[model samples]
Target: MSSSDIEFSSSDYAVQLDLIGRVNGLTAAKNFFSSLRDQDKTVKTYGALLNCYVRVGLIDESLSLMKKMKEMGFLSSPLNYNNLMCLYTHRGQFEKVPDVLLEMKTNGVSPDKFSYKICINSYGARADYDIMEKVLQEMDSQRDIQMDWCTYSLAANYYIKAGLKEKALHYLKECEKKVGNDAEGYDHLISFYARLGNKDDLKRLWDLQKSKCRKQTNKNYIVMLGSLVKLGELEETEKLIDEWELSCKTYDFRVPNVLLIGYCQKDLVEKAEAKLQDIIKRRKIAIPNSWSIVATGYMNKNKMEKAFECFKEALAIQTQNRGWKPKAGLISSILSWLGENGEVEDAEAFVKLLRTKVPVNREMYHALLKAYIRNGKEVEGLLVSMKDDKIDENRDTMKILSLQDQNSEVTG
Candidate 1:
């Protein structure tokens, strides 16, 4: 995706395997590349296999395959060097990177801008500005190769990571000048200006990019709005959200409740109360994480009652969509909060509900015991069950007994 779309070829079965692995995952890629090797062993094969393994995060395998490539007389080409540098650079493995560069230079393979980008990144990672500057000087002499956007964009990024904001800004402008009004350059400028906290420049760059592209429609606005919100620029985020409502289709989209309402994450009670209308009006998010965010926000605000309700709502939504029980664990903390807040009756109700939902979950079992303890009745019998260490019986008969007792207490 970084480079231009490669034309599909039979010789590139390994490259295809690598791409598939990157998209799917390392394990999937390994399985795929191995299958390609099995397809034909006599030909020039594993160069792509090595590249794929590198891409899919099989760094050791990629390296081992590099040695194997030499053994099999697959002479190291520019693509081979490029892929190797990419592997080390992407992984931030600096010591390994120089060894590859040394190999390239020894073999009289002239390194290019992208190759130096890896070296700059390696030095940037260690904050070694001296060597980084040396690499930049060396790069200055290689400008006749016609450095592309990727070249200086990487330089800008490297400087930014090195905490040299001025240098980053300079290189970024140089990148723009090289491209002469490219759309992606504008996008990079927007990101860099945002990073620098130059809100005016950021907005200006965004506007320019937006104008060049399609007419700032709903989907595009959503993407931009998310990027702004994630940057923690609350005022800018609000401005974009309001702008979207004015110009674009609202559709069924809604921002995260906490982001929309400025809800304090640790104050779940107040967060839920503040966004209560949004919570109801915005169709529920199937992500358990969103529910947890609201729930935590309410709890931090000591809004225990609202927090409990939010978690329960999230549990139901999560169960329906994903059949995932990950969030059921939150009930333990919620039940604890309920008991602490003297909401004994609510805790008992939840225990009754849990029995009807997941009968054998440990959290439900604990809630049932806690509810009985709250009422000051039949704690002795449950303690006896605990003492017997009848773990499986606890999973079944004892849980049922506690549920029935809680139900009787609640109903009566």
Candidate 2:
């Protein structure tokens, strides 16, 4: 457009600034804003830059830019103020959020639904129910403001957190009235009812959602499955999984993972493993975390051999699921078990696989030494590797070495 002599509109510049921030980061955004002509620095462009600052969490820069925007009469809309309030909320400066709302009102800017919601949330977060109620009342009394399900649902959530069951139910009823065939609203209400352990309501809303909404999304299934798991309704969870599997066009392991996790939490790890095995037998895709979940459950039950088997299953297909690493404590426990009772070859293979995931550490060396000593294998090569890894001998290392020496004496 510049080459064609087309002038850059203010909206264009604003959009370009946002894109720069997202694609090239804050420094590039700043450079672009700085390079803009003075006339091009309209309210939209300036607000865009402010959004960039807030998005990146540059608190001081956001405030300074906000001040500059106000000085230049660019603070007419409530958007910039809302951005600041959101920033403060994300930063956990809940106390400062209401003040921003007050400032917006005092500046003669009409607060939007979002502005009121943010303030209500701030008060709720601080657990100031009285003030939260007052803010809700104030928002309700606004002649221009039309209350929505989100505000009511948000209030219900905080009420649930506060253990005000009656109030929570009341607000949830209000939220349901406003839901009016919206899937997301139903999802929130379902989750809240689950939190309250109201299974009847959970089933009711889910049924209603399935009938009213034309298509159930994966997210909806995930939420419902998670809710059932939370309520310990494993039987119902299984039925729902079957329902989802039949209808779902694409398979998502997360749907069953909810049940897998539920099984583990309830100490029914064998059931979880069975379910995973069934999925595997059907040639379905399962992530490492799925196996790891079962492994963790077995570990809790002191079934180290079963845990080791599950852990190996997870490690075998780990490359298929990037960014997944076994928990360090889990690995340590497995290593200790292998050193005491596992084959030397098995320990060596496990440690070799472990090196790709985590750095060389004292725990790895110790596990290998113990396995070698127990198998009556030579320790010279292992000691050289440990020294080359620069892991200095500690008390535990010395103890393991002492054991190796005693084993040698016995052999000699």
Candidate 3:
């Protein structure tokens, strides 16, 4: 069979090109699009190719494509200009965002609320509060544009980022008024309120959400619990957990994990352990994250034995071939501590376990070397393994080797 064996209409071909772009198959999408002659190309086809370039981070290609699009008289809509603004933002060229917005208006493509919102974000990102406010005011004054909760919430987020707490709170209140029983909108407010540390407002909004929605889903409960935990209101979180257990339709460990981690963060390791034990007693399988949190808690309190036990439990339950990586700092600390004070066999076993989660890095090799030298074990094979892994030995490795030399001399 040849490439000509396949038959596709222009619309079908264009649609497939767009689908390919959506899946990030940029090369295939561009090649397929380029094969079509000028007569077969539509504005949508051009837009799809442009989107493909954008999705693949081909900024220069996208810019050239935009020029071609304008020459073909298809760049008349705000959507095309919005794409440029988005590309600029993604590339950290924030200052160029408002320029694209201005060009859109100059070309007689009436700016939509999203266009204005992007400009607002651009200004806010640069910390130009005055221009951001001006853009917001102009957006509000536009008769055709009805400001939505998302836009207001976006503006509130920028205000918070700028440390303009008063202005941020004002916009948050406005965002709340525009919410109107939108679950996602309520969730956004809950998150922002958590950041602002306004427990009272968070509680009030939580109540409002419950009353407006027919019943809370796991998402709703999780968001609310997360807020309470951030506020360090563990008592309230516990009560809410009990309530959720009674009312929830499904059992999700995520909700309880939030509080358990919170307890550990506050140095209440015993409480975290009890919660973990309770979950296991109920025949629920705890995730590696749950055990990792307890391990972190023990480490915080300087209980190395308990911490190692918890870390072992975490590794035992770790899912293989999943895109999960433990905290590199925790891994380094535990391995270093163990190498300094643990048996060589134990260090080797833990490193083997860690390779199942993350790639073998210099830190792991360093820890293993320290263990081997401290226990008077041969390290020639370990040095060869490090070279094979392409991890260069640094000063720390030299120090470990020197320690081995001293130990051998003393024994001799």
Candidate 4:
């Protein structure tokens, strides 16, 4: 558009700068902002650049730009201050967030709904319930402010965390009154009810959500399913999953993974694996973590053989889920099991596949050495490989080497 005959407005330049920051990194965004003519450096463009700096977590740069924006009288709106509050919140500087709100008020800029919400959240996060309640009261008293379900829900969440059940229920009731037909609002209410272990309220709100909300999304199902699971109602969870499957347009594995996790948490590994296998039988796509979940369940039960089988399944189709990696503790346990009880060839093959995901570590080498020694196989080549990999022999390595020597003496 810059090269075209189209006239670019300040808003267009701001959007372009935002896009550049997101796609090309902060340096490119800074360069683009610098290239802008003085007239083009409007509040919109400056705010966009400031947003970029906040997004990339450049604290010094964000503050410097905010100072510049303030000096130029561009801090007339609540947006600039809100961005700073968000930055502080994101960086875990929750205590500083309220100070930004105070600054906004001091500058004669009235705090918007989001501005008040952020301040409330910051106080809640700090466990400063006195100040949080005071802020909420002030926000409620503001004539221009119309409190939404989200604010009430957020306050209720913090109340729940503080173990103030009555206060939490009050806010939750207010939240429900404002929910109207919003599915996300119902989701929060459902989750909070579950946290409170109020199964009846959970069911009531769920029914209400289904009746009022036009559609129940996958996220909705996940939340409901997870809530039921949290209440230890696997039967209800199963029924909900069936309901979701009947109407869902697209199959999302995360929906079932919720129950899979629930089953494992309840020490029902066989049930979880059986459910996973049932999904696989239907040719439904299950991610690697699904198998890993079952594997972890078996590991906890000390069923190493079963764990090995399930984890092997996870590794076989790992390429299908590139982002999935087995947990380090689980991997270590499996490697140790393979070294002690697995076939020498099996250990080598598993390690070969494992190396692709994690760095070749001392645990991998030790597992291989144990397997080779147990099988009465040659260790010279294996030691050479370890040396090539720059894995220095430690105490465990020396102990395994001593075992290998003892085995050689017996075999000789």
List candidate 4 segments past 4 Å from native: 3-5, 58-60, 283-285, 356-360, 384-399, 410-412
Ranked candidates, highest TM-score first: 4, 2, 3, 1
lDDT of 3 by residue, 227-256 (tens): 998999999999999899888776777778
Lowest summed lDDT across 10 adjacent residues in model 2 is found at: 279-288
Candidate achieving higher TM-score, 1 or 3? 3
Cα lDDT of model 4 by residue, 1-412, tens digit: 8899999999999999999999999999999999999999999999999999899877888889988988999999999889999999999999999889999999899999999999999999999988998999999999999989999999999999999999999999999999999999999999999999999999999999999999999999999999999999999999998898899888888889899999999999999999999988986667888899999999999999999989988888788789997899999999999999999989998999888878899999999999999998988999999999999998989998899778879989
lDDT of 2 at 269: 98
Per-model C-alpha lDDT, please?
Answer: 0.62, 0.92, 0.86, 0.93
Error of 1 at 232 (Å): 7.0
The estimated TM-scores of all candidates read 0.67, 0.90, 0.90, 0.91
Q: Best by lDDT, which number?
A: 4
Distance from true location, Cα of 404 in model 2, Å: 2.9
TM-score of 1: 0.67
Q: Specify the highest-TM-score model's number.
A: 4
Choose 1 or 3, whichever is better by lDDT.
3
Q: After superposition on all CA atoms, what RMSD does each candidate show versus the true structure?
A: 7.5, 2.6, 2.8, 2.4
For model 4, give the 10-residue run with minimal summed lDDT: 279-288
Q: Per-residue alpha-carbon lDDT of model 1 for 28-107, expressed as tens digits?
A: 76676566534454234566566666665667777787777767766455567778878877777776776787787887
